[model samples]
Target: MAVVLAEILAGLGLLFFGLKTMSSHLQSATGRRVRALLRSATRSPFVGLVSGIAAGAATQSSNAVALICGNLVRGGVFTTRDAIPVVAGGNVGTAALVFVAAFDFRLVVFYLLALVGFGFHFKLDRRPAWKEWLWVALGLTLALLGLDFIKQGPRDLDVALISQALDAGLSPGMGFAIGMAAAALCQSSSTPTILVLALMQARLLGLEDAFFIVLGANLGSGLATLVSSGELEGTGRQLCYVHILVKAIGCAVLLAAWIAVALAGGDPEAALAAAGGSGGAQAAISMLFLALQLAGAVTVALARGLTERIAVRFSPPSMEDDASRPRYIHRRAAEEPATALDLSERESMRLIKLLPNLLPDLDRGGADFSTQERNAFWKGSTAIVQAVDHFLVDVIRAGATRESLDIALRQQARLETVRALVDTLHDFSGVVGEFETVPPLAFNLSESLRVIVLSLAEATDGGTGDDFDLLIGLTADRSEMLDRIRRALAASEAGGEADSRRLMHATSLFERAVWLVRRVAVALRPPPIEDRAQDGDPARQEAPEGVA
Candidate 1:
């Protein structure tokens, strides 16, 4: 009994670790691609199911696939109807584990262990060639090890004692209820079903009795998924709902078939074994069941597509108009550096207006965010920086007349400086935990950044125009303000309290912001192009900024 118990624990441990490792690896690899696929595939219910199955198969985790689908739905990538099919497909894909484990694969465990150990120990090396393949091998081995333990371990259980207990405790309804609870507890229908099968193989439970339990197991798995999936909304929640409906319907059909067979005076165990014998054919039967599950999923996906089309026909209008959409520098738009510069200016101006409120919004404890919301904010920020950098790269690459090159170089340098500033701001936002530092420093520093950025916008549009004098004035004013902030920060530091470290950090960040603003002013200040041209001096034209 102790040995059997030990095998069970070891098997469970291996199973959990294998699934976790496999899920993490697959998620990291395919997560973004799957997200992209769902955006378009969610058009029809069938497409959703196929995408769900494909992604779930790739990642080996239905929950991850479902959660991602849900976030996409909330992000407006797909409608709830579109998500349903994919989610249903995910349910079918999740059962692929049963197919894999059904095979005899005990020998792979040695390779698996070595690979995992090597990968863990050598992770810091930049050139770990084919490390991923090793991880995959290790995961598959762990899965096989667990399956082998399950198949071989149960024969030694005290069957007669367990049978007596079950006979006293289990009605058809009770068996079904227990099976559902077990599946829910396990969180993987594959595990629960295997456990139930193990129980039967040990002769502790009859086959006929196990049939209702399997029915309960499917329902329980659906319910468990639904309950967990509820934490998400839109496509994710819908996917779980569709999965539940399909399983509930499938179970009803199987349950009725079981009852009919019993009424025909057949033993359920004898019947099941005869239908699919105890040999490799049993494996075939499991595979067939999996295929049927996939077929059901495909059908569900088709239904969801139709449902989505109908919903779209009656969709409501959004509150925000197209004109209200904020424009930012786009990678495609960067081909035209002048256009990119224009977009960047607009983006800078938008950020300036947002500065006062950004900290407050981020700081608000009650600000509710969907996963999509946070992802959009982060992705948008990344995209903005990337687009701007692309523009700068293009400008640098295009070698021009010496005079033109000097202007371009200065502009490029200015952009690089501002990019550094924005990156620092982004870092600060992350450290301060999304707008938690809503104080005067954040406010004033943001305002100063806006002023410099606006000055750049003017400079980019044929050299600061009327704001050239304004830029100079603002630069002098900001210099004075920074000096005051620095003195205040130093005084705060002199107090030498325990919180001085944090305050000093804040001061450092503020100083960085000030420096970025000053750089922006310097970059935007027009060189004496008119004077150099009038003097007909090419040397003066080629001078870098600040040359005597």
Candidate 2:
């Protein structure tokens, strides 16, 4: 018992390690491509179904595919609806694992591992692009090898004792319960299903018991996944719902079918006997597992509309979900640096546009956002900034004209300012909201901050020449104004020591916000004709309106 337990532990350790290695590398390699694939899936359910199958087969695990899909959703590349078919197809793809295990390719894993190891030894997998796939291959082979070790480890145990204790007289309900428990604990159906396959092959567990256990494993995996995903919300949670529905639907359908067939006098055991003993039994179980997954995938695919509606009902879209995604920047634009840089700027425009909502108390248009909504907007805006940052990096790497390079370089620098401005404004809003009695000095500073952010948004979004001049004027150095506000706050009879501290802190953030906004405007402000005429000039001349 001890030896068997040790083997199981070893196998599990290797299996999980291989799983992580394979998934992280594969996800890294395929992240953007998967997003593109899901976008295409929006055209039709059939295409979505195909995308899921490819993602699963390429990654070779449903859990990995779910994670890939989840990250894409989090990044705002695609919504959950676009991902459902692909996720369902991934489940169908994992059925291939059952087929592979049925063939008992235990020896093949070592040869594949050897091939990969030698490839590593020869440095054949060292190329920048090829490296991730090499790791993927290694991880995949090791996972299989670990599974093999798990299967073969039980040979030393007393077969009779194991059989009697486990499945010899196991009732269908008990078998199903055991399978559910094991799969729930493992958080995947693959291991439990494969273990049943090993049991059948060893002639220690009967076909009926194995069938129930396999079905139960599917059901258990769904429950475990749903539980684990308790923290995910909005579109992110939709993927979790799709995952559960796939397993739950498949298990329910198959279990019902089995009951109906058994009641109709379909002697499954006799059929296995006629087909030739344990080999046939193993084949039968594998096919059933495939059938179960297929049933789920098909149902989810055909009911795509219904599935989406159900998911949305359970987890409605949040403001952050919409906010986090990039509107204009995408991978395709990378080949055109000018166009990509333009898109990056447009994406950045979204950040400044959201600044008004930060302090509803100060926005000129009179905004009102719940604490939750404000936080969501800020989170989403941050995601967009990060997305634009990544897009700009790709633009720089794709090569460009000197002019485009200048724009890209300036944009990169501006991003730092935008990030700082966003943080400053977020902090400024928190501190400004702390007042029990709003002071005129603090209120004026807060309102001015909102106007600068609003004007900056308009300036970037095709604002006229006059608009640019106004933004540059608005955000110009406020060191003098901040000094005045600081003095006023220090002398005023504020609420208390805490109020005085908050007021002073808000002044500092206000100063930073103005400076950061000015930096953004200066970047947006074109170089003066005096500098442009010098053509050979380094263009280091100060922007008009002292925005330098």
Candidate 3:
């Protein structure tokens, strides 16, 4: 009995591991394409349905599809109403894998496929794309083989002993409990459903029991969405809740149907047996699963507005939902270095958007941001920068790949450049305020200062190469003009000592601001694709000065 239990556990472990491997590889191979399809094709409900189905089928994971849809909604690429249909379609598409697994393929065929996949995976000149597909094939083969082993364990046990141990027999309620437990433990509905089907095929489990188990598995599948929603809020959180609610409703409807049938003195088992035995039962269960998914999809699609309203009523926006705080970066995401880095990049971009507001407009005679506003801006900027810095450090410690580390380093440099620009803005604001008190200057100093300020504003407004180049040229012209004015002021007695002092202070601020803007522009621009390819270590190279 111990040996049999060991075998069952081992087989389950292999099955879960195989499924995880297959799903991850399939996502890696097709994730970008699936995202593109979702973005471009989700214009209407029908289009979203088709795209979601295709994405779920390609990736072999409905949860992955839901997460992608959630991200799209967060990014404003899709509305919650539009994402609902796609998420619904993902449920139907996920059912295809279970249908395929129900077939009783020869064991030798799986072994041969696994062997061939291993060979392809180890090939000297194999492409990365081919390697991903080979891994997926290998994982699928292992899962099928494991399913066979799992069935063999129960068959070896005495039927009488197994029935006696179960206590509740092969009743639907017991099956539902068992199914929900297995699915929750595995974090996958497909694994538990497939296992139940295998047990039924081995004659160790009844058809009616397997049917209820599949229903329970459907309900258990919502746990993944529930856990993921903990990290999200606002529209993203609402979308996840909608997904869970749809699955729960479907489960309730199916359970109610079963209860109603029982209450009417109908023998579901007798009906199932009359259909033909286990084979007919399997087909019926598959059809039922698909039907439930479709019904849920249709119901959700018809009442999307109502679903949104309910979700909002439950998860309204909170005070902590301030735009200044980093939305995506969180401690929960630390384990996923790639996602963490991506979040850091997004938060950095938000910080960059504040640059234009920081630049003082001298033509208007004062700074655009009031003193209180500037202080607030500084506080917000510091928080975002520190958050990104801390997040990057965690990503590095989490063992990010070299490529990802390089990207993080680039972001760090950009943040430094932003800090420098902010400081320069502060100094420029102070100088402008001091000049406001002074008398009118000789040698047209105010006009010259205005031109310099305008040029700096234009350069910092856009981080493009052209903008930086124009800034360099303007600064050079201003530098030469400053020298001429200095010489003229020295030769004449009309210009007072106070005027020369103010001119020197303004000149110092203008030069520093120009230099900071140039640095920021360089940090923002990446090396050309070909240049990066040739260098092979573009991250080590310093950002070129005055390069277009």
Candidate 4:
């Protein structure tokens, strides 16, 4: 008994270790393929399902697969409908552990180690072909190692122990609950089932009892699916629910079959053992399970299609779902500083795209909106700017390589400059629209400010001259433009075409905006990253007025 228990525990450890090894190495090796697959999944439901299966199998963890699926769905790589089938496939694909664990276990550990070593060394090689081959070698090695480990450990367990444990006078309800608890504790249905099978092989329990436990195991597996479901919402959530439903139905069917066999005066254990032990029996059971999994996958696919149809019927036709936005970079990617840097850059670009949208309202004297709207806009802008700040700080503190840090510093300066300019614009808009007292000079400054902002925006977008050169040019042009607008407005007021006081006030507000815009641009440019690095103390004084 002690020997059997020890082997069982060892097998569990190896199973997890092998999976961990495979998932990490596979992700490093096949990250591109998985991302490509995710992108492709958006095009079709069948493709998504197949891709999910392949990805899940490679990762050896359904939870991770689901997370990626959810993110991809969020990222617009897959619609909620398309993502459903893929998530279903993920559930089934993750069951590979069950099949693998039914075999030898130790050989997998050695193979996985070899693959890891090869991957690490080969990654450093300059040859592209060598690198590609190395990744493939690593993936295959880990899979083979996992296969071997599963084969070795279970075969050595006492079969009677499995039989007896299964037969222990526990009610079907209690049995199901036990299975759920066991799976939850193990955090994997595959591991618990493998443990049960090992006990069966050790002669610890009869085959009839093993079958009931297997049914219980299926019920327990649904719990895992449910937990995974929480990661998704709307259609994705519904499809996950379907996964649980299918498994529950399968468990019921199997349990009923066992009862019928037992009542028919037949030895349920002998019958079950006959089915499981014989090649034909094993094949039949495999086919049954496979069919159940396939049916579940197919059902979700259909449900997803129906869901889309219903949604389109009820709601106006739209080309895209707004919820499709990438969330949660895998924390593990932080281990690779370069990858982390790229992720940070992607996030910055997302913010950049959102920033320009804030300009229209702020440009107009629409700042006197309803209190809620005004506050919302203010809070939103501040939140965005603060987010960028936090992201930059994190990049610096994360021990990012020098190249990564350089990239981050550039983003920081650009975003900060944008924020300052936006603040000035907002303030000017509010002031001009609120006051009736017009200052001619202020009106001139407002027009100049607008032109300067527009020019700066263009130059920034074009990535043209250095920030300094562009700002200086814009400032000179803006001064001239401000003078002309102010003179024209003052003349209009003098000619009695407009209210002199209101015009004067508008002009005054505009001038203030123009001055702030110039300061903000200068603040943004600072010194070039390369030059700053060369300085003994990298932090330098802010760029002076018109220094460019």
Candidate 5:
């Protein structure tokens, strides 16, 4: 009994490890393909549906597809509208994986292991790209071997004893609960479903028992997504909500139908009894699982707009989600260089407007966001800037005119300068915030920096050259003033080294910040009149002021 238990335990362990390894490596290997698949969803709902199905089958995990879709949505690659069908399709894909797993790989496992071993010995995994493939192959081999062990290792065990132990058998409700718990723990319905397949093959679980567990596992996979998606914000979690809704509805409908059939005295697991072991029962259950998933997917796909509305209501978009996306610049506009650059500039102004928000305490006039809110804003803004960069790159690649190229170059420089300006201000704000009582020098300097940020924003919005001229004057020749402030800080502190050091660092930040502010002003300064005349846009002589 002890030896048999040990074998079973070992097999289960190997099976779990193998499934995880295979899924993870498969996901990694298919990253680019998966992204391309996601993009294709925008082409058509049907194409997106197909892509989602392909992605799920390739990765062997629908949870992965959900996460990827959410991220892509935030990136503007997949809108919530387009993502629903794709997400629905992933259910079918995962079911496909279960069906594939149900097949007998007992003989192939040895050959697969041998091939993978030779490849590793030959150092195929040493290559950057080939490494993931080899691991994927190895994972598949381990999974097949583990499944074989799970089936064969218990083959000699007494069926009568197993029957005795399960004499009362599992009530459908109990089986459902166990399946739900297993899927939630593993975060994959396929894991629990495959285990059920193994148990049925080993005669440890009846077909009816496996049915309830598989059903529950399917439902639990959606719950597992919700359980794990705490970090996702905005429309980013919309996918998770969609997942749950689809799964919940599918489970209810399927379970109700199954119960109706049973109550009417029809055998749902009739195929399990007629077919051979291993493939037969496994395939039957897998097909049923597929049907359940397909039913939900098709239903959701049909009423996608309503489904999306329900999901969004459940998990509304957050400020961070709003900021993570670009407002003006988009890939389609990149084809027209002048329009794209104009859009990029407008988008940039939005970011500049937020610069003052970075130092909310110093800039009391602006909205006062909590630290967490500020962090979210910062991340969202950063992602937006990244999107801007990608858009600019696309414009350049699409063949811009000399004038547009020149504008692109300037805009690119401006982005880098603003990034530096924001970074310096961010550091300054952190130091000023850390002071127990905001010091006079720190307050004045921060206020000066904040005013300059606001002024820069104003300047870029068609404010007088007076703003730039004054900004240049404010940033210039602060060396003597710095020395006076340092001495005042050191002497006023009454011998505390930490205070002096912090004040000194704060002053340094102030100096760098003003310098960056000047650079930004210069970058945003309108092009010289002569250069504008040389270009065809005689109507566009005034230089556009850049924001924050």
Candidate 6:
């Protein structure tokens, strides 16, 4: 009994390891391409469904498709409405795996494929590009091999004893519970479903028992997704909720139908015999699972509006889910410093992007900066800066490589610069808010300041050194104009000494704001390669004559 248990445990471990390895590598290799495809293909629901089917089949995991869709929605590439059909089609694509599993394809074929994959990986010049696919092939081979081992494990034991242990005291509810537990433990419905089919083939479990187990496995797959999506919020959370809800509803509907059939005196065993015994039973089970999934897909697609309403109601946004918080600096991504850095960079860029919106424009004179807008902007910008800082600290603690650390440091520098820019912009907005009371002479200064701000904003928007020299020239021209304004205010007596001082103070604030904006643009600009080799002296590489 102990030996049989050991063999079973080993087989399950291999299966799980293979699945994890395969899914991770597959995601790494194809995630960007899949995202791009989804973005381009999701012009309509039907196209999204086809894209999802292709992506899910290629990756061999519906969860991967869900996650990819979730990311697309989170990134604003797709709406929650668009993602629904893709997720549904992912279910259909996942069913393809079960369908393929029903065949008796020799394990040797997988092994040969893995070998060929490895050979290609080593022989190819693009090893980095092809290595993930090889790992995926190897993982599939190991998973198939693990299934074979699991099937052979109980052969040497007392088949009657094993069968009795599984079925003698097991009610349908108990079978469902067992299957759910197994799938959750494995974090995979396919593994447990295939195992149940193997048990059916060994004559240790009947088709009726397998039916409940398969239902439970489907529910368990959703549970796994729910657990994984715990950290996601807003649209990402909605995607996960949709996945779980659809799966649960489909499984429940099937379970109810099965109960109704049984109550109507339907013989499940007779049905299995007619389907062609054990092999037919496995295929039938796969078909039933596929049908339930397709039914869920059709139901959701037909009522997309209602489905979306339910999803929104269930996964409504929280205060933290608002734009004020760091949207892309996902804590879950901290384990991968490169990903964390990328997310942090995006969040920082978001904060910087808000600068133009937050800046008060006198040219649009009647536009009022409402209290609500100001408060929200202030709160959101503050929260994002703090969140990004905390996230960066976490990334550092996660022990990044030297290259990753350098990237993180650069991101941190950019974050600090953005913070500075925001602070300066806030002060400048306050100055502009008092523009109504300013003397007429300050209008020319105001116009000059506006041009400077616009120019800086454009430079920041470009986000490249390609225009740094141009910005530097503009800044120099503005600085000279700002000096003239200050000298005129100092020399004037028409507005009285107090008005002159106020005008000068406002002008000073604008000058400082322009300088900070220019600094941000310069900081964001990548240094030339020639200067990069200076080893920490890149700052010493001077801009053109106009730039300080």
Each model's lDDT comes to: 0.59, 0.77, 0.66, 0.55, 0.78, 0.71
lDDT of 6 by residue, 41-61 (tens): 667778877776776666556
Question: Which runs in model 2 stand beyond 4 Å of their true positions?
Answer: 41-43, 74-76, 122-126, 167-169, 269-278, 325-350, 359-367, 386-420, 427-451, 454-512, 526-548
**Residue pairs in steric clash, candidate 5?**
352-548, 460-545, 460-546, 526-543
- Candidate 5's C-alpha runs over 4 A off are 1-33, 125-132, 135-158, 271-279, 363-367, 396-413, 416-436, 463-466, 476-516, 529-548
**Residue 447 miss distance in model 2 (angstroms):** 6.2
Could you give the candidate ranking by lDDT, starting with the highest? 5, 2, 6, 3, 1, 4
Q: Model 6, stretches more than 4 Å misplaced?
A: 110-114, 117-122, 125-129, 272-278, 324-350, 353-518, 521-548
Clashes of 2: 1
Give the range of the ten consecutive residues with the poorest summed lDDT in model 3.
Answer: 316-325
Position 244, candidate 6: lDDT: 75
Model 3 clash pairs are: none
Give the candidate number with the greatest lDDT. 5
TM-score order of candidates, top first:
5, 2, 1, 6, 3, 4
Off by over 4 Å in 1: 26-51, 71-85, 107-129, 215-292, 306-357, 361-506, 514-548
The residue-by-residue lDDT of candidate 5 on 1-548, one tens digit each, is 67766776777677667767877887788765655557667677788778778878766677878877888787776589889888888888987657756777667888899999999999999998899999988887776676666656666667778867765867888999999999999798887887777677777778778888988998999999987886887898999988887788788887887778778898756644444345467677877688778888888877889989998999898988876788898767989998999999998888887787777565463247666676677778777777787788878989999999998988888888777776777788778777777666777887877787888777777655556677777678688888898788877765367767888999998888888888877776554564456565756766465521
The C-alpha local distance difference test score for the whole of candidate 1 amounts to: 0.59
lDDT of 3 by residue, 102-134 (tens): 666656656767586567767922887577777
Candidate 2 local lDDT, 304-340, one digit each (tens): 8899899888778778887787778877788888778
Score every model by TM-score: 0.64, 0.78, 0.60, 0.53, 0.84, 0.62
What tens-digit string does per-residue lDDT give for candidate 4 at 1-548? 46645555665665566566657655665655666567666567778778767766666555556556644543434455666667667766766655654555565657666766866775643565456445555555655554444334555555665545556766657656766777666655555555555554445544444455556665576567557555354433444444455456566666676689889998665665465555433333343344445655666666676645553443332212222233423334445667766775565445433333333333344353543343345444554555455546655777888887787787677667656645655565555445354344544455556556665555445343365466765564355665676677766745354555555555555555556556545644545644445454433524444554
